[model samples]
Target: MYIESFVEYNYIGEIAGLLLSGLLLFVMLYVRPKKTLLFKYIFNGTILSIVAILFQISIIKVANNPDQYYNKNLFGIQLISFLLVYNGILYCIFSYVNMMSVVRRNQRKEFILMYAVLSIIYVIGIIIEIAASGLYTFTLDGIDIRHFTRYYISAGIVCAVVCFIASALNRREISRITWHAVCLFVPTSLVVLIGQMIYVVKAHYIFSATTYVPIFMIGFLLFHNVPYDELSGTQSIYALDAYLMKNMGKKKIWVVYVILKTLDIENFIKKDIDSLYYGISICRNLENLSPSLRLYKMSDNKFVNILEESDPGKAKLIIQEIRGIFDKSRVDLDVPFNYTIIAGELRSETDTILKVRQFFEFISKRFIDHNSSQFYITKESDYKGFSEHYEISSVIRDIRLRENLDDERIVVYAQPIYSVGTGSFKSAEALMRLKVGDKLISPEVFIPIAESSGAIHMLTCIILNKVCRAIGSFSEYYDFDAISINCSSKELSMENLNRDFMEIIERYDIDPSKIRLEVTETAMFENYERANKNMESLSSEGIQFYLDDFGTGYSSLERVMNCPFKTIKFDKTLLYKSLHDDRMNDILSYMIEVFKKNGFITLIEGVEDESQKTYSVDRGFDYIQGYLYAKPTPIEEVKKFFNRKSSF
Candidate 1:
């Protein structure tokens, strides 16, 4: 009789097996399995494929009735060996598939029952085979049958049980394709069932040939059909900015005007871009909640929600309630959520782009600087603090974007920096002031808002362009002393910082030494290595650094080691509190002394009162800056102050 084998069997089953094997191998290769364990799965599947061929060969031998042609001894050896191999292959398939099934579902009760049943039957079979072996002298009609019976099958069953448990427990962490193989293993297990049906060795080839249905189906499922993405399981999100800008032109981008409440949004949602799209989806639902409302994720952790330009107050109420959903959902929520937030409201629709950025920036700044304090917009009717001023800032944002010029919206103001010991002006700190209509606004009012909205860089360029021009106007009046421009720590971390600064410095025809960069402790320490490298590069080229706001934030040894600033600028709070606090004076004294010993110059900020100025002079501070010297004045005032040394 002819035998069925991949080697000998020419049935549809064998052809499908070969084709499927080739496809699976391609997938394994495509997955780029870099790890050794993944290769082990490949090796195991290969071993199973080889066994199918071997089983086919054994069937042909058994069907020939070899004892009639050859010796009975040869027939017995062949017969027993084939039985053992058949059982071995069956056990392997059963164990592999069963474990895969168990792992995927993870029902311990069901697993235990399955294991018990499989265990009992196989254990009995193994015992019968063991007892009939020659060692015990037991035989069937005085002939031993133990070798042909059960020891290997029992061991095989035990191994299968163990593998099943391990695979079931680890389904998720494994690769999707591996899990595919794991889940479909149930059908692949027909090898064992077929072997069991054809218990006699003579039918092994036929069973192997007919068993490709499950194999073909599993192969189809593994490569051709699956829900997960073949690569990253999610799409890229960097296109978001471009997408919004391209789709919604400046006029249609009206979402910036709606003022939402404080609701913390995670910058990077746990899932990928597709997952983050859900936040936009929920925001889109706002339109239905109020037909004119518009929403989109402006940037990471920042969303722009707009209402009608004609009716901003009506829009604000609707948006406020929508934001309340986030806050209300925080407790025992149906979904995993975080409600911490700080929001900035923009009143002008023209400032749509800038306003969205500012909302995120405002919150980010609180996170970046204020140690998790929340900045919220209280109602104009409820609280009269900075509501009107905040609205004015929005007006300024729209103006800045609209002009796109070397001058407009932002005007230059300078505050004289004086030598404390001599009480003579040394330089002027260039302050950027945004003007909208009849109102003149300080950087303190709009600069922070600019930084929060990611428009700080744009503001910086405006200020630098103005500062350079402002300096050009004053260049002939005095020898160049440094003009310090306030830069965001976030901006420092932006792309090509050194190149950007260099270009600005070169364009202004300003000496690098005349520009002293100031950074707060929080900004300096946030990304110390990048900061250090940037500072070190600038410092090497003759620029200097002043550590702004010492004695605030996580002030530690790391700041001292990492920050290479040439000057230490004391925070206003510390100097203000120093007058009343004896211990605080000691702390400030130690801080100043350490900085002094390091050869860094000290400039104490916020010398608003005589006592504070007297304190800085007595404390050996090299310079002092604040309203005590002068409130930030017009450029002409700064020129006049620096031109006349004894102006104080």
Candidate 2:
């Protein structure tokens, strides 16, 4: 059957497309953020498209010079080239869908197997088309038009339909860039399909489909693939934020936050490559645990997994499995490593990316403070704890911003310290109390949050100012030697700590001698140089520094002696344990003697009963502070203890 073939091939347009696609390929490879697995797939598709375009250009060249290559079986070669071009275009479409599946983390074994089957069928069809059509009839009118069978056309339609179905099924996972590319692709593809049908009816050559390959490649590079950590190959925190914002109300997500504490130490010691390898290994193992898990590396030591899970129980089970993975890794590795995992179901109805990030920080701080391996915010009570922490953080932020001591949200209480030598209440420790509505939030609960959030310095300054006020107000009537204020490690490391403290004490016209700063052994050890400098500068101004929570930290006696501390406050745990164990009692006595010999005033806190206080006094402790003398109370309530002396 002969027909009037009017469709003409545009060699110039085809060549322009080939050049543009090649340039885009160069740009993609040169400027890609990372050579991720997804990038490799897209890169392969681009290369295939470029090859297809080259084949189309070669066929056009051969057809134009028909007489020059007449003996080359030109028609058969053109037919094979046409099929190969369509095959490349179809593979590109499949690759786009595969990248989307990768982002969604829903690429299951079944999906992969189906893809493999479709690919095999498509390739086999190409082979069959070539074998079945060794020679094709052609009319060498103006342009050498090949009259081919409908095998390639039919196979292309079926493959295109399969790709369309696969893409539709994962439409939700398609990124904005992919959607835009699809929007452009649909109209172009329709035009190509309509033109191909027209060409077939008119017995003309079909145009190449590689013209728009660069569009998809550019879109994928610019909009689709998110930035990932170079070391761990996990998405960045910014990507997580974007993902959360994009999928907020669309699906239920549970975040499994993992922190490798040992890896953090490793990173500090410049073993970053090894730490990242360990982190990447953990991520791979976690990804293997679930098909719908997407991991993001939030920081050096922290990883976040977004699980598409609706049930809290199931999420907890997954988290437990994750903990087991970490535990097993610790046991399997040559070096011992410790890890913490905290998982909580995201409230899609009300949670924002910021809130989710804050939730992560809150739980991380809780884990560090409690030293627990795993935590699941699956229960209402657990969420309530988070809510309380959020509220307390808000209160602290308000206090810091307002700088109003009269707000009453932040209150200060004083616990009296009894002097064993003079047998009188000679000193008091200023403690922080946060009044949230009617109930008081414990320091144990909010202190770590404050420290983690960088609000501890503000809290420290407020407490110092309030204590100075109290000392100035009650010193006329009270006979206390000094009021001790607790300083956190974060506060001690502050470069402006001395300036902030001196300003407050100077403002109230209180003697620096009347203000004693209580620092934990851990705090001093955290940034020894800065803490020591701050302590020495403050001590030189007549403010005594007390090494608080002595036995709770790892500090050598020589280090403690070199520190500019006037006193050592033994922790309650040491006192309680020493009372029960005779060996501990001897060690405690020896420590007190050593400190006293070095001209350090020694105090044993947690002296509750008569026996404990008597043991403390007999051991020659200079001071005692505990519940047995006086529980922490308001500055006004502590006045009665000023004149009272310990019976012991």
Best by lDDT: 2
Per residue, candidate 2 scores C-alpha lDDT tens digits across 127-171 of 764577442433433334343324555555565566566666755
The residue ranges of model 2 lying beyond 4 angstroms of the native Cα positions read 1-34, 37-215, 218-224, 227-350, 354-377, 397-407, 474-479, 636-648
Which residue pairs clash in candidate 2? none
C-alpha local distance difference test of each model: 0.55, 0.71
lDDT of 2 at 566: 89
- lDDT by residue (1-648, candidate 1, tens digit) is 222222222234445554555565566556553232123333355455545545434434433333434344554455445444444444434433443332222454675566567656654664565456421122222222223423443344354446545656664433344445555553345345345334423422333423433443353343223321112121112233444445444333333322223233443243343334344334434444665554433334444444444455665566566666555443323334443343333434213444345434433443443433243543444223344445765665675576454756778888888886565787777877877677777777777667655667777777776776667666666644778887788877665877877787788686778777777778866777787788888888887887777778676855665567777788889887888999998988988888788788888878887988888889999988889788888765577776533332
Question: What's the TM-score of every candidate structure?
Answer: 0.46, 0.65
Which candidate leads in TM-score? 2
lDDT (0-100) at residue 33 of candidate 2?
Answer: 48
Residue 90, model 1: lDDT of 48
